[model samples]
Target chain A: MKIVVCAKYVPDATGDRKFNADNTVDRVGVDGVLSELDEYAVEEALQIRDATDGEVVVVTVGPEVARAAVLKSLQMGADSGVHVLDEAIHGSDSAATSLILARAVERQRPDLVLCGMASTDGGMSVVPAMLAERLGLPQVTFASEVVVEDTTVRIRRDGDAATEVIEATTPLILSVTDQCNEPRYPSFKGIMAAKKKPVETLTLGDLGIAADQVGLDAAWTRVDGFTERLPKSAGTVVTDDNGSGADQLVSFLVSQKFV
Target chain B: MSEILVLVDHADGSVRKTTAELLTFARRLGTPSAVFIGAGIESARDALRQYGAERVYVVDSPDVGDYLVAPKAEALAQLVQRTGPAAVLLPSNAEGKEIAGRLAIKTASGLITDAVDVTPADGGVAATQSVFAGSYTVNSAVTHGTPIVTIKPNSTTPEAVEGSAVEERVDVTISELAKTARVVERKPREATGRPELTEAAIVVSGGRGTGGNFEPVEQFADTLGAAVGASRAAVDSGWYPHAYQIGQTGKTVSPQLYVATGISGAIQHRAGMQTSKTIVAINKDEEAPIFELVDFGVVGDLHTVLPAATAQVQARKG
Candidate 1:
């Protein structure tokens, strides 16, 4: 089996993930980490590769920091990596990002493609679906458990209203949830092996995508304006030493018309 | 007025409240049309009329609902072509967003998800989105093609407005690729009799402080007619089901009122619910970060404070 896992480099969710002056995520100023969610996708792909004795390649579409994401996946057991970096790719929305990934994935010609359910920063969770649409591939997303038997893939999707067991043939797109598997830490030997893994870094010119086709100017959606939310004012806090705390809470709820 | 098409969210033909919310929001932009897929049109017609769906476009084809979201996207794309609608609205659920994403790409339209508000602006519809876990509010509009927006629940108070309720049957040709992922089995979640977590106006959440007991939280939630949620700590510790977990990787809910019990208000937990209009926390630690964001906080054990509050509410209602 030939598998390709999509990886993303996102701002550390724990820190102050601020936006640039242009309203895009400040990928340069902040500490970047391989998105916590993508680790699950990489681990799933690696497991599948191990079971089938096939190759796993990690793909990323971002700026320079995205290269690190690919490296992290390689360290986790991806056989090789592909990084699509271009200056014009900055400020691209999920739609454009999907287009770039589709182009990159088409180049690899893999039998299976995997992605995280959603990125930590944007949290749109739409890219995998968009990419599947562009590629005309069947997509089984939000998989809590994925089983591969021969060329058939079955996934358990834990939705809000129901739990669905979805089945699809290989050459389809699959996105996994955090509960799918516990990702492994990179051993010292694996880290050294990743350094020797082949990584092909390409630009838009190499992929036949024009600069005008992407970037902020070609975006279908525009952020007209934005505002930072004001810090919540300090709230009232009362001790329960007298056991009147519940009454005070009731009174507050009444005032807010919530009771 | 041009049509603002809304994909009706439903189960077994019973329309969900989010569909009414979408219709009410659509009225602000243009004519509201309900795109109903699969069975149960008779059961849903009144609700559609009550919420002001001027035209109810029915796609009764089993092909759309039998498969995953791709076929639904195909069906909507055909409707967009036929109606030349000004915009489209869908519930911001997993399936809805996927359909919207595919539709946007198919029709070359702009897509926005998790919009808190949508109103007419600059000759088109502009959506207000609470981003970065509600720390920032941004207003955006589709600059290219028709605006396809997925809205969150409880963003606006749905009002009843009777409409023409004309019905139109739509026929769509589903592609072979859209039929590849087949749902082999489906098990509906057991009913809790509480409101859906994301759609609930009020949510009561428990955390590590519950000590593996959710009785107080459930009792309080039932008393208030609110939904029950849980922090990751509670879910990870096997105190609560993972479906009820509310955090960065879990569900994001913006309710009118949110009550956190025994939660320390970690950033992950806050990201799931910080947009709530009013917040209240019950924790033993007065210094818990949850207190900083709450409108009112009680420094006490939830075991004691919640049961007392539940009884007090029942007495007041009586």
Candidate 2:
């Protein structure tokens, strides 16, 4: 069995994030690391590989900085990595991104594909389903727990009002929620070993995708403008000197029509 | 005016609040129509009619309930082909987003998720999204096909405007690929008797300041009939379950009233609740960041302040 995990390199949430003139996020000079959510996908892939004695391949689509995302996955027990890098891929929307990812996954021809529920930067949880649609594979998404048994994968999805048991056969796509499992840190030995692993690089031409089909110009949706949030101004503050804080709060709630 | 298809989110026959909100918003751009996917259209019809649904497209097929989001997407896509609606509205939950994404691909449409607001623009729809953990607001419009939008819960208030909810059955064929993911069983969650966190009007949340005890938070939430939420600090400390977390990684809630108890608001935590209409913070430390966005701030111990507030609310109601 071969399990492919899709990962992304996103700007650190704590770093100063800015947008460029093109209304795209400026990820060039900022601190970039593997998206915190994708770690769960990698961990799930490693667990499945350990159980089935399969090979785990980490795939990513981004600039040169995104190679680190695949490298991190390799250090965490993945066998190999595939990085799809190109200049024209910048500012591609989720649909275009899924197109490139589906092409990459076709080259691997894996039995199972996994992804995080959403990316930290875009926060759009639509790529996995779009990829599944493009690849013509069944998707079991937002899985909190996953169990594989004899060419079948079952997952527990916790919804707002109920918990559902969803199952799909092998050669399917699944996106795991953050509740799946705790990700492991890379060890010194594992980091050293990852340096010797093979990391394959591909371009849009290699994947048979035209440059006109992606990039900001080809995006179906474009950001017309963006505004930074204003600093929150302080509201009314009261000290409970005479044990009247609760009363004051009630009065304020009444004034604001919150009660 | 062209029709705006609102995907109804419901359980059995009861309509969810998001559907009503979607229908209310849909009336702003075009004529509002609802697409009810499973059985129980009769149970949901009154709410649909009350919220200005001109028609309800019913598809009572076992394939929709038995499979995952694929069949539902297919059904919606088929309706889009038949009705030629200007836009499709769905709630921005996990299932809704997936169905929207698949429907976009199937219909060659532009998809937008987590939109806080949608309005008519240049013969199409323009959407506003809170991105980068609510630090940036982006306005976007689709340049391609019809817009398939997934709106966030609590983005709009539901307003009743009576209309006819005449049911029309939609015909669709579920593809072989969509039938691969089958739902085996469904177990209802243990009822907390409180409103859902995302849809609740009031949310009372605790953080690390609770020191691993949520009893006060639960008590306060129960007294006010509000949903109980926790900051990431509390959830990471094992004081609360992850499902109850409200932060960048957890659920985003835009409730009418949000009460913060013992939480020193981090940006991630604030990202989830800053959009709430009214906020109140109670913490012992006067310098907590949670006080910055609150409409009212109480500098007192949460253990003391929350119980007092709960008692006051309960007494006033009685």
Candidate 3:
């Protein structure tokens, strides 16, 4: 079994975010790490690789700096990495991004493709579904647990109020939810071995995909202007006057029509 | 004189509010035509007509509805090829985003997801995206095939324009290749009697300070007909479902009013709900980060604050 795991390098969600003069994100100073959710995708791919005896290939599309993300995944026990780097690939929306990824997956021809439910930076959980559509494959988005047995994969999807079991055949795509599994940490040995692992670099042309087909120029949408969030006026902070705290709270609640 | 294809996001042919909103946005760029991908087209026709869809392209194929997004994309791709619409408008939900992505590639068109607004520009739809956590607004136009845009819910108020929408049955054959994966079974969510989160006018979310006690938070949410959300900490602590997490790592939601209880607003959490029109926070700590972005703040124990508020709302209704 062959598995392709799509990963992204995004700003550490916990890092301080700064905006550039143009109002785009100042990603340079921020720590660019593997997306937290993508880790689970990588981990889930490894789990499947372990269970099925196959190679786990990590793929990402970004600038030259994106090599670090692929390397990190390699460090975390992936067998290999593929980086699709092109300046023209900059600012591709979910649709364009999925196109690039689908081309990469087409090049690899994997039996299964896995992705995190959404990227931490964009939080647009649209890629997998789009990829599934582009690849013309079955996709189970937001899968909590996926167990591959024989030729079919049994998945548990966490719905609003219930858990659902869905079954899909092989050569499928899954956008794994965080509930899938606790991702494994990169062990010291794995990290060191990753340095020696081969990470293949491919340009958009190398994948037989035209860069002109994606990127900011071909992107369907754009951002016009952005404003910082409006500062909220502080709400009333009615402190307790000894035992009268509850009464004051009730009065305040009544005033707000809450309760 | 190209038409705009609006994908009707509905359940059992009951059009969703976002559908109306999409039609409202679609009409801005081109003539509005609805693409209903479901089993019940006859039941959906009246509402589709009411929302200014000049034509209803009905694909009442169970094969399209039985599976997930792939087949729907195939069906929409066919519609796009047939109508040569000026643009395609889909609700910016998870499924809609996927459909937009697939349809974009199939038609070799430019696709944009999470557009806050859409307008007519340069003989095409100009879409704006709130990017970089709403720090930058990007105005973009698809230069490739027909522009495919998915607008987020609540991005605009839907104004209905009653039209003589003629229903047309679009003959679509789902490609066997499209059904590469099938939904062997579907488990609809146990009805959470509350309103949908994105469409809800009010939302109440709990943060780490809740310490696993969501009783007051749920009660307050129930009182105001708001959807309940949790911060990553609360969800990580097993206090709530991960789906209810509102953060950079969770579902992004923008409502008219957002109430945070027992939450110290982390930037990641704020990324999810910062676009809300009004924000109120109740925290015991006066300096909790959640208060920084709130329109209203109450420095009190949420346990004390929320129940009182809930009771008041209940009494007001009584």
Candidate 4:
């Protein structure tokens, strides 16, 4: 069996992340690494591959810098990496991104495709299902636990009200939640092995995707305007003395009608 | 008037608060129509009516309820084709977003998730999204097909308006691909008896300062009938479950009131709850960053502070 894990290189959440003038996130120079959430997907893929004696391939669609994301996954035990890098792919929305990824995954002909619940940067959580739709495959998303047996892939999805055990056949898309498993860090040996791993790069032309079909111009959604969040102002503070802190809090709650 | 389709999120037969919230918001764009894909439409119809649902489209099929989200997405996509609504609104939960994404692709529509607000604009709808962990707010509009939106809970108040929600049984064909993912079993969560964290009007959360003791936090939350949350630090340390985590990677909540105890207020934690209407924090460290966003701050140990606050609230209720 073959497993393909979709990964993204997102700006470090701790960094002062900024957007370019065109409203796209500036991903050029700022510190970036594989999206923390996608690590779970990579980990799940590796686990499934290990159990089934399968090959694990990591796929990403971004600028040249996004190779870091694929490299990180490769270091974490993937067999190889594919990076779809093209200038025309910049500012692609979820739909276009899924289209590109679907084409890339089709090239791999994987038995299973894995993705994170959502990218740390986009936080939209839409691409996995969209990718499944574009591929005409079943999707079991937000899986807290995934297990494979023969031709079936089963997952435990924990919702606010209940937990559901859902399963699908092979050649399906699955997006794992952060609670799925603890992602493994790259060992020194794994890092050294990743240096020799093959990394393939593809462009829109290579994927048979038209230049006009992607990029900001063809995106279904566009950022009309944006505003930087204002710095929060200081609030009233009360130091506990004579046990009056609770009284003050209760009074404030009453005033706010929270009581 | 063009109708706005709102997916009703519920459990068994009971409707969730987020459905009412979506209905309330849908009324702003067009006439509100509810799409109930699972069983128990009879029980959910009253709440849907109260929330101004002009019509309730019911698809009470085991093919939808006994499976994952794909069938529901297919059903909604079919409904969209049949009705040609202005927009479709769903709760921005895990399942809702998955269904919305598939529906978007199936209908060749533009999908927006985790929208803080949606209003009529340019004959479509404009959605305001809080992105980059709430460091920026972006206004967006769909340029392609119909706009499919998934809104966060507590983005607006659920206003009850009297409307006769006439039920319409809609027949939908569940695609073979959708039926491949079948739900084998469902295990009901052990009821905390407390309200759900996202839908609760008041939320009392504990952080690393609790030192693995959620007793005081639970006591305070119970006293006020609020839900309980935990900081990522606390959750990472195995002090609480990840489901209870409130942070950038965890569930984002915008309750009417949010109280943080013993939390240092890291940006990740703030990213989840900063949109809360009113915030109050208590910590021994007076300089904790959590105080910056709080409307009221108390400098004291959570062990000493939360108990006292709980007593005060209980006594007031008595």
The DockQ-derived docking category for candidate 2 is medium
**For residues A49-112, what per-residue lDDT tens digits would candidate 3 score against the true structure?**
9999999999998877778889889988999999988878876767778878999988888988
Scored against the true structure, residue B31 in model 1 reaches a CA lDDT of 96
DockQ versus reference, model 4: 0.76
Candidates by lDDT, descending order = 1, 4, 2, 3
Error of 1 at A209 (Å): 1.1
**What are the RMSDs of all candidates, in order?**
1.3, 1.7, 2.9, 1.6
Error of model 1, residue A87, in angstroms = 0.4
Instruction: Write candidate 4's Cα lDDT for A1-259 as tens digits.
Output: 7999999999988888888989888888789999999999999999999899999999999998899999999999999999999999999999999999999999999999999988888888989988988998888888989989988999988887788898889899999988889999999999999999999999999999999999999998888888998867768899988688988999998887777
TM-score of every prediction relative to native: 0.98, 0.96, 0.91, 0.97
| B144-231: candidate 1 lDDT, tens digit per residue | 8899999988899998999899998878899898899898988999999999999998999999999999999999999999999999
Worst 10 residues of 4 chain B by lDDT: B174-183
| Residues B197-286, model 3: lDDT tens digits | 777778889988788999898888887778999998898889887878887767778888888887888777877888887777778888
Looking at model 3, give its docking quality level: medium
Compared with the true structure, all predictions reach lDDT values of 0.92, 0.90, 0.79, 0.91
Question: Candidate 4 residues B53-157, lDDT tens each?
Answer: 999999988899877888899899999999999999999998899888888888888888899999999879999999887789989998889899999998888
Ranking by TM-score: 1, 4, 2, 3
User: Any runs in candidate 4 off by more than 4 Å, and if so which?
Assistant: A241-244
| Docking quality category of candidate 1 according to DockQ thresholds | high
